[model samples]
Target: MAAFPHNRRMLLMGRHPPAHPCEGTFMSFVENLIDQVARATGLGDNSRKFVGVLASYIFSRPDGFKGFQKLFQKAGLGGIFESWLSGSPAMRDINAGQIQNALGVRDVNAIAEKAGVPGSFIGTALAGALPLIVRSVTAGGTIPNGLPSGLAGLAGKLDWGDSKVTHLRGNRKRGSFWRWLLPVLALLALAYCGWQMRGKSPPLGTPAAATAPVAMTDGTAQSVGAPTFAFQHSGGKVDVSGTLATAAEKFQLLDALKSTFGSDKVTARLDVDASVKPASWLDRLKAMLPGLKAEGLKFAFNGDAVKLDTTALPEAERVAVSAMFRDQLPKVKVEGLFDRGVEAIKGLKAGYSASELTEALNLTTVRFDTGSANLTRSSQDIIRQAADAIEGAPAGTRVEVGGHTDSQGDAARNQLLSEQRARAVADALIASGVPAERLAARGFGSNRPVGDNSTEAGRAANRRIGYEVMR
Candidate 1:
C-alpha cells in the first residue's frame, strides 16, 4: 500500500504491481506442516509449540538470519547452513548442539518457558524443524525477504509477534499429514507444469513478471523504527514511501531519486526519526540509485535486508544490478537475488599463512561509523569471515590489527580514535575465538596513508582496518 498525491500524472506501467493476496493460504500451509512435523516425531506435547514459535520468529523477521548465521560461524557450523541458505532441494542436517549454539541458551530458555517445555526441548525440536521450515518457504531456490505471500496483513491475526527475544508463544491442537498432503502435491504439480512449459507459447495477455513482494515494516515491536526505504518504478515515474532515521539521510535519498528520475516525477512520503540509528545501506543506496532506472522495478530495504524485483529487466541487466547490491551489502540479505549469470566465488581457503590472511582481509576492508570506532552492520560479515580465516592460520603465526584515519580531523584525536578502532576489531576477533596472544592491536592514525586525503573515496580507503603478519 503506497500513496502519491499532489501530482496526478498517472504512470502507464503494467497492470501487475507488487501485490499478492494469496499469501495467507501459503502461511496456513506452513502452520499445518509444523503441526504434522511435531506430531509425527512424537517429540513431546509442546514440541509443536516451540517449533512453530521459531518458525514464526524467522518468517516475520528474516534479517535476524544474519545473527543466526554469525552465531553458526562462531560455533564453526557455518558451512552446514549452505544448503538451506542456497535453498537446495535436500537441506543439510543440523543437531541440538548446533541449534543451541545458534539460538544461544537464554533465547532457547525463553522460548522453552513460553512453550511450557525445557530449554533442551526447544533446541532438539528446532534441530529437526529448522531445515524443514527453510526449504519449504524458499521460492524458486532463493529465499524471499518479506513475509509469505499475503502474510504481512495476517501477521497480527496469526499471532506472529514473538518479539520477546522474538520468541512467540502459540498453541496448535492438530495437523493431518494426509490432509495437507494433497494441497502440497497439487502446488508442486502446478509448479512442475509451469516449469515444463517454460519458453513455450504463452496464453494471450501474459502478466508482467511478478515483482518481489514489498514488506515495508511499519516499525514493529522489534523493528525499533530502524530506517526503512522502498521505491517502485513504473512507466517512467517513481513512488517512494518509508521511514528514515535522519533528515539528512532522507534529503540525500530524495535528492538521489530526483537525480535519477526528473525532479518533478518523484512522489515521496518520507518521515525522519533522529533517535534511531541510520540503516547501514543508506550511502550505498544513494550511490546505486542512478543504476536502478529499470522499468517496472521495485526496491525495498527493510532493516538489514533488501528485496529487489527486476522482472521487467533482461537477464544481463537484472543480474548485474542485483549482484552489485549483493556485493555492496554483504551483511544484509538480498532476497532471491536474480538467478541468471551469477557464478559463485570461493572464499579464503584453510591453513592460510599470516600474509595470505592479510591479503584476503584487505580485499574486503572492515568499516566503522564516521568519527567513531563502532563497526557498521555492513562490516559484520567481513569480520565474521575474517575470524574464520584467522582461526585457520598456522599455529605460532602472529598478526597485527592496525587502524588508520584520514587527515580530516585533529591529528591527536584521530590517533586516539584509530587506536580505539583497532582495539575494537581485536576484541571482536578475540570474541570470535582468535587467541589474544596471537594478535597485536595498534594505530597508524594519519601516518601510513594508502589513498589521497582530499577526496571522499580516498579518505574512505585511508580510514580502514589493515592486517599485517607480525615479524
Candidate 2:
C-alpha cells in the first residue's frame, strides 16, 4: 500500500470548514480510513496501526459508528472504554491477553496480517496505544459523519482535553530489575504467537478458523454510500446484519436462513427501516437459499434484481453459471464486463460532479414525505437524471447518496431520517435500472448545514440529499 503523506502537524477536529473531497484526491476508501485513524491515534505503534484496517472494515457501513461502538461495548467493556477517554492518569492499559480476549486470537492474527506485523506484536501494541486513540476520535466530544479531510489551517482551534494516560509503563516495582522485566517482556513477545488460534468469539469476530463445512452470511444489501454490511463467517457460524425494507420480509428471510443454515448456527441483526426498497426479490430469495451449498458464492440483491457472484468458481464455471443465472433471473441484467469490475452506468452523462448533480436533481427534485422516506409523486421522475449523473463522472463510477438535515428536532431522529431519505433515492434509482452496486446511501444528521439552522428555509435546504462519486 502506498503510504499517505504524514507531516509534523496532526488534523485535530474543531469548528473548521467541512473537509472537501478535492483535498485528498489520492486516497482510497480503505486508505483514507487507515490514514484518518492513524492521524487520530497519533500512529503510536505499528501493532496499533491495524486498528485503522479494522476501523475501515467496520466504519465502511453507512452508519459505521454503531458497529464500532458495538465491537467493544458489547464485550462488556463500556466503562473501560470510557476511562480511556477520561483524560486522567487513571486511564488503564490493556494487555496482549485483553486484545486477544476482546477481538479474539483469530481476528488479532488476521489484523496482524493486514497490518503487515507479526501476530504477537499486535495485541501488545493495541494494549499500549488505544488510550491515546480514544482521545483523538472523540476530540471535542463529537464523532464525525464523513471521515475528516482538511488538515491545513484547522489546528489548535479546539483544545478539548485529552486522556492523561502515557504509553510507557516505566515505573519499576519496589525491588524489580531488568532481570525480572526482561523475562516478562520476552514472554509477551513470544507467547502471543505461540498460542493456538481460538476461532470465532461472539464479539465482532473476524477470520476465525471454523471446522464446520458451511459458513453463510445474510445481511442487508446496500450501495456504496448507504448502510452496507460487513459479515464474518467461520467455523460453521453465521452472522446477519444490516437494515431491511419491512418486518414481514425480515421474518420470511430469517426463517429461510435458519432453515438452511441450521438454527443453532445463525446469528442475526435484522433492523427494519420502512424507507428501504421493499424486497422485490423475496419470492425468489427463499428458493435461492437452498442453492448456497457452494463456498465462495455470494449474491447481491437490489429491488427486483438478483445477481449471483461466481467469482470464487473456476473461470469456466464462473462464466457458465453466470449465463445460467442470467437466463433464470430476468431482472439481474448480468453483464459479463461487470462480473467483478466497474462499467459506466448506461446513459449517465460524462464528468458529473456532486454539485452539478445536486443542482440538476433540484430542478426535477426527488422529495420524500416530511420526516419519512416515502417518496411523493414528485420524486419519481427525477430518478433517471439523478442516476445518470451519479455514475457519469468517473469511469466505472460508484456513488454515495448523502442525506442531510438542517437542525430542527432530535438530532438522532434527524440522522435516521437522513439515512432513510438517502436510501429512498437510491432505491428509486435502482428500480429505474441503474446498477445496484453503483449506489449507496447515508444520513448526515444535522452536522452539515448549508443555510442557518435557525431559519426554516435553511433547515429545509439542510434536509436535502446529494450524491458523491466514490472511487
lDDT of each candidate versus the true structure: 0.60, 0.49
Candidate of highest lDDT: 1
lDDT of 1 by residue, 293-399 (tens): 88777877777877677877787887667656665776676664553211110254565567777777665555565678987554555566677777788888888
**Model 1 ranges with Cα > 4 A deviation:** 1-288, 291-299, 304-346
TM-score winner among the candidates?
1
Give candidate 2 regions above 4 Å deviation. 1-239, 302-308, 315-324, 333-471
Q: Could you tell me the TM-score of candidate 2?
A: 0.25
Model 1, residue 288: C-alpha shift (Å)? 5.9
Per-model TM values vs. the true structure:
0.39, 0.25
Angstrom error at residue 418, model 1: 1.5
Worst 10 residues of 1 by lDDT: 202-211
